[model samples]
Target chain A: MKTTITILLTVAIMAVGQAAVAEPVKIGMITTLSTKAGYLGEEIRDGFQLAIEQEGGTLGGIPVELLVEDDGRKPEKGIQIAERFRTRDGAKIFTGIVFSNVAMAVVPKLVREDVVYLSANAGPSKLAGDGCSPNYFSVSYQNDNLDEVVGQYVSDAGHKNVYLLAPNYPAGKDHLAGFKRYYDGEIVAEVYTKLGQADYAAEIAAIRAAEPEAVFFFLPGGMGINFLKQYAQAGLNETIPVYGPAFSFDERILGAVGAAALGVKNGSQWTHDLDNPANIQFVEAFRAKYGRTPTLYASQGYDTARLIGSGLAAVGGDLSDLEPFKAALSAADFDSVRGNFAFGANRHPIQDLYIREVVQTEDGTFTNQTLEKVFSNHVDAYAESCPQ
Target chain B: MLFFVEQSLNGLQLGITLFLMSAGLTLVFGIMRVINLAHGSFYMIGAYCGATTMAATGSFLLAIGAALIGAALAGMVVEVLVLRVLYRREHLDQVLATFGLILFCNELTRIIWGRQPLFMDVPPWLGGSIELLPGLIYPIYRLAVIGVGVAVALFLWFLFSRTRLGMQIRAGAENREMIGALGVNIRLLYTLVFGLGAMLAGLAGVMAGPIMAVESGMGEDILILTFVVIVIGGIGSIRGAVVGALLVGVVDTMGRVFLPSLFRIVFSNAYADSVAASLASMAIYLLMAAILIWRPRGLFPAHS
Candidate 1:
């Protein structure tokens, strides 16, 4: 009996040693977790983790290792993390950046290192414009492309005058510019609040004076919540109909503002109520695991993970097959939360933009419902402008 | 002319709210001589409390009341438990300890309220727009805010310039040991002063809740602006906080509104738009820097 037991133990030890030599694929995830930014980062982490778990902890016959590093919402920290991942962690692919500046900083580093970077949430405009690079593929839409729909919706609806407001930063400027692109209506005024400002009284007062037919804005993160709440409080919602991109009216923000977001319209590429097979599965799995409604950020994150999965699979488990892997991702053969989509010439996403109305769910939870569809099979106008 | 009048009102209103925040911070600094970086955390707590209570009870007044009281309670608890031990400690220790409090409180707030923002909204009756000028219609909520802020400032002025407790607070601010020798209960007074400061900070947070996001780190952002107010107004002066806050708010507002048009005359429209946006954003910091260059101690310093 003792001899038999010893033989069995020896066989188990040898099998474990063999497993240690198996090929491993490492994907670096730099996110703003463990901070207020974690609201979105947690969603990103969950989406990636869920995809890996669904694949039974393996991607294309190799065990996957997700190395998550906190960027702390700092652009410099993101680059540092990406450099560390490339040099030390032996990661061949980089993913996840919730803020645009962080993505702006890390995208070049990953490209310089010849490592593929998948932007999960941030939609920096330059990456789809003059700064476009081959190694950088966005699993998300351009920041302005989404906002362009909001401008178009308001302008086409014959709104004569609109007010524009955003935080005083690069993202905010891009947002206002994008809005004016599709919106030919007379812009009454453009007000830029301080970056990360908590109060909007002066801005609110300015909005009051503007008395616009409509208001279009792009103030993501905490800024969005402050603007929306203050706008609702100042009774601007009743005076002028508000329109924005996905960030202003998403599940991530609705809970905080709750009924304050009621009647607010936002343009997005996807919504939880998108009524598609891919989205249904994605939403179901996310809700089941998280016990809450997933935001557009989470949906985009899940698509990015699937994008990485397809690239890995197409290369036949070979991490070194960069050419074949890039081609597979470019072909867009994988499932996405936004349904059928493909990367344009600039490597930015070309997908449908959905106009969602902020409405509470049947379960009394705050969520956005798809009201109308805008910009079907939308290709970013910046693709032509891109010097790539 | 009407726009200027309206802009002045806007500036004054902003100043008053900043005063409410800065008044407490400066008092805590001047009296306690402890740099409480987590002071903003208490403000956030008050805002959250105000928002949650208002949402639950559907009473704006009650929410404000709960916010002030709750903030005071949180402040006193910190004074007794955490800050009391640090009274005789070094500035580095005080700063580090308070920094830890900020992290702990921010996370605690997140755990309680979740990651989403809470909509502490304006009451229905207070949420209508008033036609102040022919073309300019201002929200009645803002007008109410102005009234409240001004009243609070006046009330605070009276409290400090009048009552016996105010006298004791002034004495304490002048010299803790001298006041202690005069048979004053220094410990109780410190807690009371902290509680009062916290209540004022809470008042600002609750008042601003309907106009801003009631979330974790909300106070931290405003805290920086309030620091600018203190630097501009002079520390530990209620009057200075008011003046500084108003100037910062109005200058910031005007810069954002007119800078683009001003730049449009010299630069191309696209360049002016981006450049103006960047400068407008930096205007307040520039003003702060300029003010510091002229008056290193502040416009109205309580101490020489």
Candidate 2:
């Protein structure tokens, strides 16, 4: 009787040990989760989770664990989270950072440590240019892509004079430079307001005085909502059309701005209405799961997840060696939600950009509707600066 | 000349908004001797209440009423529960407590409303712009804000100077112990004063709801400016708050408008713009420093 009990105990222990050997890969997601701009991270998280859910709690047929921590929109906090994820959790692959500043702080160090970092958002120009790394990949567009598209579109539309406005920040200056790259027109005025400014009465009055044929602004989050509402209230929207990147006209922002954002032309790489199987499935699945239309940030997050999944599958879920996994990621083997998506030599996105107009659906919800393709297979201008 | 008029009007509108915010902050400091960093929390609460009420009932008047009552109730509750104990404590303790309250209120609002900012539109009656001058169009909502600010200032003056309650409150601000000795319920008076101050802040919040994003931490941005207004005007003086608010608002607006153009004559356009924008944001601080250098107690020192 003692021998029979010992055999049963040994069998049970062996079964448990076998299960432990197949433990899931840990993917650390360090993103902004608490701030006025927390919604951006929320959408990204929801989108990334939706893809995993669609795969039945696994990515690319391999069980995976997603560890998400809020950076609180601070770079120092982001570094702390990354260190914890690396040392304590033993996470080898990392993704998800919402802001360029935080990304600039965290990404370089992670890549230097030989951990693969897939960027879900925040493709700062430095990362795309001189700082590009084999261990790092941006599944999202370079920071300037959307703005460059708007610049080209505005120029094509024959607007001879345009007034530009953005916050006085590095990203703001980068956006204006991107716009100027493709825009061959007279810049009537280029004003940089204080970052996080609530009022635009003085600036709006100045724009009226300048009498620009068109206006382009790059105020993201609540700043965009305030500017759009105030611009409409001033009755400037009726005479002078406004243009911007997708940052200002995201679904959540349009809800806040109400009818003020309607008919505003903005440039984006993906919309819910994109005519592609992956995107259609993503939008439908995301809406079914989350009960809201996904933003462009969500699209980026979903794409980043799928890309990582492809790399994992290529390595047969074995992260014991990272060279093969990196190679698989660089090969770009995944169906991206943004159609024709590819990685440039610098590992930033090379994809078509489109102009989307804010429109109210039949159900009376505000969202972006794809208007026309603006740039086909567009690559970031900084690709040449990176030695890949 | 037309551009100047439009810019000046814009400055006046900004000044009026600042006045509403500073009035409450100054009153609270003057009466309670409590430096409430959470004063901004009341503004946030007012905005949230107003925006929620506006969304549900679709009545702007009801929204205004809701904001006033909501903020006043919150203020009175804080005065009774937490601040009553801290009344005799050091200003550092009060500051620490109020700062914690600001975080608490911000997080509480986020939990209730979610992180997405709430939307409040200008009431349809006040939606469009009016032709103020030839080639100068301004939003009617802004003009309404100016009108409301002016009316409230007049009402505040009447309440402080003409009413018996106003005299007692002024006396309390002058000497809290003496007023209590004269049979005035000091605790009740403090609570009432805090409520009134919170209500004024709420009015500012609701007025700003249409123009600003009604989100958590919305109050912090304006609160800094309010503090500047109080400091420049005088800590306890309503007259000082009024003058300080208008001056800060006008200087800020005009500097933002004209400084870039002025700099362009001397520097390259792009260089001038960046330099001027940085300087314009600093203009009010420079004004405050200059004023402090001349009059250390502010433009109107109420105590002496």
lDDT of 2 by residue, B201-269 (tens): 899999999998898888888889889999999998899998999998889999999999999999999
lDDT of 1: 0.83
- Once fitted onto the true fold, the runs of candidate 1 whose alpha carbons sit more than 4 angstroms away are A1-18, A59-62, A204-211, A362-365, A384-388, B85-93, B130-137, B254-296
Q: Relative to the unseen true structure, what is the Cα RMSD of model 2?
A: 2.3
How close is every model to the real structure, measured as TM-score? 0.90, 0.97
Model 2: per-residue lDDT, tens digit, A1-388? 9999999999999989978888999999999778788889999999999889889888888889999999999999999999999999999999999999999999998899869999888999999999999888999889989999999999999999999999999999999999999999999888999888889999998988888999999999889999999999988899999999999999988888988998999999999999999999999999898888899999999999999889889998989889999899988899999889888899988899999999988998789999999899999999999985
> For model 1, what is the alpha-carbon lDDT of residue A313?
82
| Candidate 2 global TM-score | 0.97
lDDT of 1 by residue, B1-304 (tens): 6766766776666767777888898888877888888889878988999998998999999999999999999999999999999999998999999999999998898888887677767788898678887856677877888888878888878888899998998899899999999999999999999999899889988988887777778788878888888888887776678788888888877776678779989987667766887898788899989988999888888788
- Residue runs of model 2 more than 4 Å from their true location after superposition: A1-16
- For the candidates in turn, chain A alone yields TM-scores of 0.92, 0.96
Which candidate number maximizes DockQ? 2
